[model samples]
Target: MAAENARQVEARVPPQDTEAEEAVLGAMLINPNAIPVVTDVLSRDDFWRESHAIVFDAVRGLYADNNEVDVVTVSAELERQGKLERVGGRDFVHALAEAVPAATAAGHYAEIVREHSALRALIQVGNEIAEMGYKRPDDVAQLLDRAEQRLFAVAQQRRVSDFLPIRQIVHESFDRIQSSQEGKAHEGVQTGFKDIDDLILGLFPSNLIVLAARPSMGKTSLALNIAHNVGVDQKVPTAIFSLEMSGLELGDRFLSGAARVSTHKFRNPRLLRQDEMDKLVRASAQLTEAPIFVDDSAGLTMFELRSKARRLHDKHGLGLLIIDYLQLMVGDTRAENRQQEVAGISRSLKQLARELKVPVLAVSQLNRGPEKQTGGGPRKPQLSDLRECLAGDTLVTVSSTGERVPIRDLAGETDIPVWTLHPDLRIGSRLMTNVWRTGTRPVMRLRLASGRTITATANHPFLTVAGWARVEALRERDHIAVARRTPSPAEPLDFADDEVVLPARVAEKVPDERFRHLAESDVLWDRIVAIEHAGETDVYDARVPGTHSFLADDVVSHNSGAIEQDADLVLFIHRDPTDETKKGVVDIVVAKHRNGPVGTRPLAFVEEYTQFRTMARSDDREPF
Candidate 1:
């Protein structure tokens, strides 16, 4: 047993390279040039040996103060910090200086140290993940998200940049200016439209550009136009995160716009003429060659989106990112209010743009207040209008395993099958596709005779004795249907012991306060005892696709904004209703430009083709 314990201790040794750590420290101590290179990659914690870490910390301290970094200076800095005796005194520092053969290989040695440090971090993360698996958190999605984030954090350690001297920054700036003068460095990815490009300087990197407008104002059309121009015309790799539309739908629109054919005719191929069909075929072939990747998954949390974006950026060298309609995104569940959630999301998007060194174009929706103004020709959406835009604790049974889980815990789970009722009042089973966070709305809690209650929006529907009725339409004493038998999932849940969800029989055994056999039903009819307004809350609706309804609280149920400051640029799409002469002309309002002039750029909206283009005068035809 003692020998086995010894082997276990030996096996548990962390990854480290003491030789590389000493070599890097020795190089930095001897040569001044090696200090900058070493500092770029290695930090104090990156060193395996305690003595080497103390020496490196001293060297960094000297460098930070703009002092020459050498064996003498590092020793003095260590002595000043009262760490010299702890780090083997001045003799060890002199020995490190003498140990290095050359300073030119310091960067290579530093890389070795950084790599070992990264490996150590990864090992730590693995241990944390193992502990998490042992604990078995209730929300598996959040657990997975946190684990992914820990892994990403370790990977990002290598990319950490140290503070650069002003001299180095000035030299880089001068070089960039010279390159620009020589016509070698373009400002940013150019949108095909000259007018908009002139205003915003062509979507600069490390910037968050928000394109917002009311529904059907061609915001998505314009965004896709820019994406097409960058990915197809400029040959830059682009990623599109579409929360509102499916990838297939976006593909069809892209084909229609690029082919210059009417979307209506394109969707119905039979209506297309021979030339239009040829154009579409040619456009489809061209689109296949473009470097535009699309992820149309619904309700992506910020962490999931960032993880995907980082993967794409690493794999394909992403140039631009576009998100359609920000309002559909789910922020951190811990946020106390919708405004705070939006603010967090806004800051995260900006951080992502900066981290990837790419431009982020996010689509946003405006509140209805813009449209309801009394004296409006066309109510232009302002930055403030962007702010006002748009969980049930009910235990739901997993149709597959008959495990009763809270609906709120399943916010982002897209593939869990649940028992549901079709709009035709037929009982069936379907995947609880998505839990969309329809932001804060007035809710009503209805109590049933069986003591089961559900809080939902007024429009949320439930199956009744008479056809399906919404919470608002149903009166008191109305009988609602509940499933009596347990749903047999394909496989038994492995996480039955996590206390996340209890099986029907387990609920009866445990008899916890939260545990009730409300899920056990066989077409049981229960009358609504009371209906009361439960105040406003961030409610969620599950999308059970074909059935269009999910069993909530054992009853069949029907399914169903911030960031002005964090954004580098804000664009509002406005269509003038009073102007009849310029039929489809819409104004791209640059509401806020952090570093440039704010103005409106006129672009023509081709409604039939679902495209945006440069406006043409009566005498001139300018290709957008």
Candidate 2:
């Protein structure tokens, strides 16, 4: 009974087989041929005992150096490294060779050692995970990701896929082709555009497709149209990670496209006609049954995206995954530079597509290179432009529940409560998901009808009468929304007196009571009096995901790229500069197609519906 109990106790220890470790080392010592076979599968760390590990390391070192690896050579190597006595000397080394029955079982013994090593690694990871639980890490998603990575590392140690025979791979390929011919296997999910579908075949599984364009080029609109086709039309479960736009805004776009109504009507319901309203109701009812899932969570990290996607896939089965612009998603924070971080993100996205066995459509933004091109009717975007793709120095101020706070100090802060506008132009409180400085840029100052002037980047979008429009798009008479009442924070204004001509600087010139009077209030429309250049200054933007817009200097502002190498298909959207209304022909340039032809396909942008439709001809005419 005591012997049986002792055996059980031994079994309970971290999974390790001392006898297998000895056999592997012994087989290597006996047969010179076994050295190559053993070394391929087993590392020094595979041995459970310290002495056995030391001996194995010595043998491996000798073999690596192209020196003879036998009992004598291994023992001499260990001794040279001052580890002979520590690993039980020559006597133990000789015993290892004598104990093995035959060298033929070296591969089997090595496999046993590898299995135990993996188990031991698993135990170590379990312990680390338990400690992590006790510590109660702040970011639970990151902690879970770390735990999953640790377990996968152990599994990967034992997993190896040798090269398959060409004959077998050819048979598999033929089978797939036959199944596709018989309509039993699909080439890929249809992208809803006949020209796009024909050019690249379809959005194939395990492929990363990048859709890139400059700002206001309708990148989001085109992506949404394709997503709608796949999800609502075809009944394929689609996951859209809208890091920039909110879920409600996406819904509005979807409704507008489906009903063939103008998106402007959705934002300003007063403009909605009875016929359009009927179309929207019917469209909403039809789309209510669609298998589309949207996660409008702002500033999502790569790990969080993977975890959520895996869970979503496991539960409802995902056929397609779309990320609205890849550059917005972050990778490992420890990356040395922005370039490394983006490259890591790109690689991770490709891996994600392969792992999930689904098509990943990632929207990308082009750098300012296209805009700076001279002598151009319309500068066509290139795949290389994806490597590039910020807002102004205004002291940002946000108010919540009648309390005023400086937006500058809130950078990097999360879950801060603030009021934001919804798609229907209604003001509601939502947590500011993320806040960060875009960059220092030449700002444009807009003087409001109330004599309140605010400065921001030319590309920064504000809540205008005709929905969100950038500073460059805003005209002198265009009415922008602002808070109707000043925030009644208990603290008085403390801005230092300066000649910087900033909004903050203007605040210092007024009395404490007057500053409070000019503080951010309820939502009201304010007309633009004058718009002019305000030199250059540091500008900040906040991400309020569900609303996509945030209060900046008492006016709503829209919160504002990457590796193309891993992409199997690279597409660029080219809208003519002269088509300022964007209600015209846009070219979908297939810049890089790994398995097919590359050319431009013209698509018409239905401005009212915010949808992309196939062109009638190459002359840039709409089919409709």
Candidate 3:
């Protein structure tokens, strides 16, 4: 049978010409024949494993009522039906196929991968060229020529060595076949499964996407969102290795996503409707068929994650990989340094993206400072906000007001908030990302819910240059301004010795006189609009010397013996607006004086005001 198959194979070989002979000799290898082996179609169990499952499924897809493998015929039909186009024509393909000797267990493909310096150099060159970005058409042609020449040598060599890491070949193969063409090609399965699809697609794959925020702002929800899209919608098989959550919990989230129900709301099965149950059942059936694999492998090190990802890719053509959160996993490399461990994890993720050529997303936590209560707008998360997990591609934070629009922040060098949702999906009548600057309250301008993906949008990521420069200058002045100038030459005359020439908007604002003003008499205050009392803000406030209650001195025409509401030697203690830490609780201390002192000395007491901005309405606090 082997001899007959060998003859049949020999009959299929094409004659080689002299011109082809000089370019390179395919590694002088002999073609071996096929052998018949018995297999059970009616096996003990109807389960397929490894490569056989995908290959056989594709074969089954090619079958028409006839039960036979008609690979060539289907390919021909696809071409005829305009589903595919023949590249370099059939003759070129045949010639190329003839050059490749069949691989055997002893063929040593791995070694070929290991020893193929030419292959490595070609890959390096390709990556370097890619990094160079778009080149002129002629240069592109030259690059293609160089790339083809490499394959020509490989074809001629006709050797499949075992040393080649399967992951490398898989990645290269995707690039060669998919990216080499002009238009976009979509991978069929959304695997909610893997990162390989997007990786092989040759797009920008981000390594770290920190989804930091106060807990329960849908960090896990968005991770699942990406995972589901890449796996199920994109058909890129994926791996989700979570440390905090069990596999079941993660799967439940996917179930919620598939069912279009809120994850928190889906906690109880008994409350689910009949339709929901039916949907769950259908989802389960589909999920069973889905290529998106989950490994709720807890406590994975960076090394283990990579190793597992490589195996998933090599064995089942994995497409994407996701790690729930970064801080959970520790690095395996025996480094005593915590930063090194973190750095190692970050570096490995970046390496994984490059090596696997897919977006390797790992969620991370934002530091304690991000627990801000917003007016429900997108707040531009900063790199400093991500200083905790700043080692990767981009710092991302997620914030959602349950029913409000969800915000995903890249936290670039500048404050740029990118919106991830389709506006139609938002819960509000007006839908836009509510992104504000990091330090500012969700106020005083500069909020836009623009940009898409981690990559910055063309115009929406930052304030205009003028605005940025002006704000920066103002900030610098706030930072370095010695005691407020007393009518300096740059300043307009009539300026109070300490009054800053505030922006027109601020000048327009009506200041509460209760707060102390940083001022000297205004004599040369020409350019300056108005200098009254600076408004109490979280960054600054006038605190009286001694009580939780703020002291505002408004001398009434009449005096009340109730001893209430009038200022008793109020000593304003405010924070520098530039002080990052003390800003949150800028206070005013009013040294308290008890009126129960007919002949005795006045009782000196203390009062405290918790926040600065709260002082603006201190008058509103029922004067007890």
Superior by TM-score: candidate 2 or candidate 3? 2
Ranking by lDDT: 1, 2, 3
Model 3 Cα RMSD, Å?
Answer: 25.8
TM-score of each: 0.63, 0.51, 0.36
Instruction: Give a tens-digit lDDT track for model 2, residues 79-197.
Output: 89999999888999999998887779999989998998888888878879989999998877678887876665575573324565565588778988898788763588988787877
Question: Highest lDDT: which candidate?
Answer: 1
Runs in model 2 deviating more than 4 A are: 1-143, 149-165, 180-186, 388-562, 579-583, 616-624
lDDT of each residue in 1-624, candidate 1, tens digit only: 999985895598798987788889889888888888988887777887888888887787677667988877888888899999998998989888887767799999999999999998888788789889999788776788778767766877843567766866887889877987897736777887778876777888999989988888888888899999899888899999999999988988898888888777755778889988888788888889999999999998887898899888878989999998787888854543344466677778998898888999999876443464335475666664443211457777777777778877888888887877543334557787666454565567888776677887665556664455667777887767655443466232232223122234545687764334333423555678889977666666555544555677776565532377678999998886766875788989998898689998889887877788877534332122
Reference-based TM-score, model 3: 0.36
Full-model lDDT for every candidate: 0.75, 0.74, 0.36
Q: lDDT value for candidate 3? A: 0.36
Compose the digit string of candidate 3's lDDT tens values, residues 1-624.
999985885575232222222111111112211101101121111111222223222233333223333335434544554443333333432343355344231123223322343444445455555554565444453455344434433333322333644655776778756754656454232322122223222223432333344454445555565566666655667788888888888777667556544455466667777887777777667566667887777777665676667667666766667777777787755532343355457666765665555656566564333344334422323323332111122222212222212122322223222112111111111122222222222111211111111111111111111211111122211211111121122222132423434333233473633111222212111121211222212211111111111100100000010111121111122223344554343232222222111111111111121111222232432111
| TM-score, cand. 2 | 0.51
Superposition error at 360 for model 1 (Å):
3.2
